[model samples]
Target: MPIVYRLRQGKKMATNDRVWCICVADYKLFAFFTDCGLMWLDTKHNIWRVVSGDMPRKLYGGAMVEYYGKLAVFWRERISNQKQEKIRCAVIALARVGEEEVRGTIEWSGVVATIPYVCGFLHCLVASD
Candidate 1:
């Protein structure tokens, strides 16, 4: 028989908005909000705490993936004038959870080659290590 599972949202999520990324790890639910960055929702306690530090701002059309038991986020960053009509240049960064830190710190591993402003989707694969 197929099993039916349901997740209940509690008081912790009462004021949370701008939910950008959501993932589950080791039975703990994690959510990354664009406005407030990362937060850990304590399902048992019905509480939430900021994951600490500032996440990349002005992020859009980005992608997040789990690589080798770690999280990796990649986004197209504007490298030129913010107000330029035809601004160019972009960056793809890779970050993972840090160690010995209460709040997870993102360590930018590397970036990908730059590309023109193309409206499409980019996918990444985590190779077996």
Candidate 2:
């Protein structure tokens, strides 16, 4: 049988809320994004936890990827300019502290691109040789 893990949601999840993105990093940590913001499953403690520092304030349909040694989060939002969608990316550097805690520091974040149409990131991938 497969082991089932339950991630704790800090806030009351509404009926329409959905998981936007999930990614794994070093130290056997699994991170996910939702209306609850970015949270990770700490395998050692068998519990879910949130990142320490700055995180995405307005998280909606988004995607996350493991890039190099950091995590890159991508999401979209409607801007004031002719109702265009603003696609943004945030690079977060992770570090483990106090045995079972993982802290995230945003290395950099900005708008990577924009599209005239309204859409969110359905998926994200990073490949290197």
Candidate 3:
């Protein structure tokens, strides 16, 4: 389910950031990747945390999905000064969260499979056996 709340003034996550993707990881928590970095809302405590773990700057937009108790954030980045770019995916484990937690940590991150050309608006789905 989706939970909605109002933003208070002078808080950390109240910046003018453009949201790229949002994923709800159960009932009480939801996370989104934005221009300012990764942020999550703790509905029970009414708190927000900026959890962009080791993510390089300048990722304008991306996609996120919940899979096997983890969040996979897929985005594209400029790989070279010649304008070469490629899609990347970051796997984040959202366990052990608390009201005072600043941000979630990225357990593992890496690039996606080789693509011949540029692309945007990434999406992910989960499967089970």
Candidate 4:
């Protein structure tokens, strides 16, 4: 089920940014890929929470989605070779740690694919057979 919460700020949510992707997952957690990193909307508390603040690099041009009730992040990392880079996917299990805090734990992370070009962009898509 999808959950919806009212923004107490009484402002418009439709704004332009470098957000690569934004989607809501199970438990009604909405997320956005922004300059402050991946953050999720806490419906219970009506606040925005960071998914991972200690990520290795400054995130840019990536995708975030929900998979099997967990949050999945598609990020790119550069390798030693200039022509090829790695695209990694991380599965994070988000849980309510405290009354005002939600924690995201990486259950699995792996290289989803390797592109033949540097700084490539990938769009988020969902499909099933």
Candidate 5:
């Protein structure tokens, strides 16, 4: 059974960040933010920690899902070049939460693949196992 929880508006440790996606894995709450990157919130301790390593710079209208037993984040890359691009770049990135070399720390992996010309809002659904 999954335990129920709620989010109450309060002062955040970090500001100017927009939450895009959230996922629960191994009893831990993970939140993906647009400006702050990925964060691992320790519910038991009531503290939040940011995951290091390669991560998407932005996640405004992205989608996240659990695929192949791992969390996959799909989002569109913001165009920076002023060369009048026709198609936006879409990416599918994967990351797993597990033990780190420091024993109690969490490490984030890098992107898995990058595709071009993908559109629409990304969404994810987990099937009952």
Candidate 6:
């Protein structure tokens, strides 16, 4: 039988929203991506928090990987001005967080690269220690 994991939602989720990827930094501490944005889940307490305030653009699809103690997200960022979405990479590190919700203190975040003409859905990213 397959195992099902139900999470408490912080807000309403769209019908098309789905979890793109999940990275577990520690026990019960997981960060995941949805069509809306990046979100945090505390399995211990069964509560969810929105970590990503405003993503520059919609992430069509992608994956999240933990590398060198940092969270890296590789996805296609939709560009309204461009015909095709660009492949971008980002590094996320937690700066400040509360027990219930994620606060505004993000240690650092930035776009590492933007590969032209590359479809993010056509590839996958892997990380190793």
The global C-alpha lDDT for each of the candidates, from Candidate 1 onward, is: 0.48, 0.71, 0.62, 0.66, 0.52, 0.56
- RMSD to true structure for each model, in Å: 7.9, 5.3, 5.5, 5.8, 7.9, 5.6
Best by TM-score: 2
Per-residue lDDT of 55 in model 2: 83
Among all windows of 10 consecutive residues in model 6, the one with the lowest summed lDDT is 1-10
What are the models' TM-scores? 0.55, 0.76, 0.66, 0.68, 0.52, 0.58
Ranking by TM-score: 2, 4, 3, 6, 1, 5
lDDT of candidate 3 over 32-127, digit per residue (tens): 544456677755566566664565444565678887777777776676654556778877776554555544567888887545445556447658
What does candidate 2's lDDT look like per residue over 24-83, in tens digits?
766455455444577778665667677777788566667778888789888787886576
lDDT of 4 at 65: 78
Q: Per-residue lDDT of 1-129 in model 5, one digit per residue for the tens?
A: 222233343443444566777876544566777667777675555655676655555676666654444456655554455422132222233344454311122134344334443445544454777
Which segments of model 3 are wrong by more than 4 Å?
A: 1-15, 26-28, 33-35, 52-58, 81-84, 116-118
Off by over 4 Å in 4: 1-6, 12-18, 32-34, 52-57, 118-129
Error of 6 at 80 (Å): 8.1
- The number of the candidate with the highest lDDT is 2
- Summing lDDT over every window of 10 consecutive residues in candidate 5, give the lowest-scoring window: 100-109
Q: Higher-TM-score candidate among 2 and 4?
A: 2
lDDT of 6: 0.56
Off by over 4 Å in 5: 1-14, 78-119, 125-129
